[model samples]
Target: MYLPPHFKIDELAAIHAAMQGSRLATLVTATTDGLIGTPLPLILDPREGDYGTLYGHVARPNPQWKLPPTGEAMAIFTGPDAYVTPSWYATKAEHGKVVPTWNYLAVHAYGAVEFFEDADRLLDVVTRLTDLHERSRAEAWQVSDAPADFIRAQLRGIVGLKMPITRLDAKKKMSQNRKAEDRAGVIAGLGASDDPVDREVAAMIPME
Candidate 1:
């Protein structure tokens, strides 16, 4: 990933926060056949390593796990994004030099990949994933809610994934390159837009 100094996210805490906040991630790996990408939810164990470890799973029928990865695997996490029209930039009114751009946050984690199918590990992974997503609910559901035999059968249909993240690349491109007036215009324009995501992007922009 390209890292311009102005947009780079180097702080470990910030990088971890971005990854955790973006629940769904794109898992990519290269193989003898070609590049494969799967979008799924991944949980981070920040205590696993100097960086952290990633946990997730793929369907048993998914070909991605069948082939051996030629190199390192990557997990891509993305945060709120919004479209910025030229009309939102003050420079457009000044000299018609501005163009449309996007404001967003992203983090890429790379490491060795391992696949497993052990029932116990799968059960643990499934239970933890369920808990993570359901924690916000007033009446959170648990793996125990389902019949034991049924849950075991369900776990058999998927393969577990473990990746000890060796490195991370994070970036927050939130109109930081724009002039103050242009950024203010962008904020006001996005904040007033009909899309809730646009308003989210507005809140992410740095004012200082």
Candidate 2:
């Protein structure tokens, strides 16, 4: 995360929000065999430890969980992102000096990774994760909706993981470096875009 002062997100609440809002995260680890990465959904427990803790599960056969991480593992979370055209910069018309860039939000969490196979812990993690995502649906689903034997059988095919976060790096590159006029132009251009995500990035930019 190469964070310039203007782009760094220092607030813990903001960082956690970005992490929680991300639907998927990439978990990366360095092992004797080299680097391995797994894409999964992770739940952040802000109440645990100093920074927080991450909980998720991986398929039992996934080699990522079997490998011993040499040091700390990292989970990468990314939020709304969009490409910014130089044409959106008001300064581009004045001096023709501006180049295209990107606007986005990202967070990197580092901690010692712990993989477990305990059925009870796996059940708890899966239940909480299910509830978090399902709560928004008009007809929510639950772990208990399935038969106990089926749920227990399903849990056997995966392993649970937890990482007590030791470090967090968050960045929000939302054109904070641009002049007010240039930023306003960007907002207008993005707001006119057909992509809803482009409009989302537009709204995140600060005028000041």
Candidate 3:
């Protein structure tokens, strides 16, 4: 996450919000074999630590859990992103100095990785995760909706993960480095585009 000062996201609340908005995260860890990564949807426990705690799980048969991680793990959360064409910038016509760039938001959380298999803890974590995602659905679902035996059996096929986050690297590269006129052109261009993600990126860009 090579974030310049203008794009850095240092506020804890803002970073947490970005993570929550983008619920899915990629967990990356280094092992004797090589770097292993898994994309998982994580729930944050904001009260757990100075930074926060991440809760998620991976398939029981996944090799990532079997190998011991030699160093810290990283969880990456990505928000809306859009492609900015040089044609969208005012500078392109004036001096032809602008180039294409992407506007997006992302957060990287680093911490010690902990894997667990305790039935009680796994059940709790799974249930909470389910609730977090299902809360927004029109027809929300719950863990208990299934037969207890079936749910318990399903849980057996996975391993739980808990990482107490120690460091956060967040960036919102939303054309903040561009001049006011260039930024305005970018916003207007994206806002008019058909891609939903582009519109989202436009909404994130600060007024300049």
Candidate 4:
């Protein structure tokens, strides 16, 4: 994460919020075989460590969990993002020097990874993960809604992961480097875009 001072996210609350909002994340590790990555959903336990802890699972067939990481593993979480056209910058008309860029939020968490197969811990991780995502649905679902034997069998096919975060790097590249008027122009352009995600990114840009 190459974070310029203007775009760095220093607040822990903001960093955690961005991580929690991301539905999917990429977990990457370096092993003797080389680098391996998996995309998965993770739940954060903010109270678990100095930074936090992440919980998730991988399919039993996935080899990522079986490999021993060389050092720390990294999890990448991404938030709303939108492509910014130079045409949206007010300065483009003045000097024709502006270039296109992207506006987005991202967080990288590093920790010593732990893979576990204990049924009890796996059950707890899945239950909490399920509840986290299902809570917002009108008709929420629960692990208990399924038959006990079925749920137990399902858990057997996956391996649970725990990572107590040792480092966190967060960035919010939301047109903060642009001039005030240029940023306003970007906001106006993005707010009028057909993509709802563009509008979401527009709203995140600070007016100042």
- Using Cα atoms with residue i matched to residue i, what is each candidate's TM-score against the true structure? 0.98, 0.99, 0.98, 0.99
- Each model's lDDT comes to 0.95, 0.97, 0.94, 0.96
91: Cα error in model 1, Å: 2.1
Q: Model 2, 38-110: lDDT tens per residue?
A: 9999999999998999999999999999999999999999999999999989899899998999999999999
Per-residue lDDT over 67-103 for candidate 4, one digit per residue giving the tens place of the 0 to 100 score: 9999999999999999999998888889999888999
lDDT by residue (tens digit), candidate 3, 132-187: 98899999899899999998899899999999999999999999999888999999
> Which RMSD does model 3 reach against the true structure?
0.8
Residue 39 lDDT (model 3):
95
For every model shown, the clashing-pair count is: 0, 0, 0, 0
Global lDDT of model 4? 0.96
| lDDT score, candidate 3, position 171 | 98
N/CA/C clash count, model 2: 0
Which is the winner by lDDT between candidate 1 and candidate 2? 2
Model 2: lDDT equals 0.97
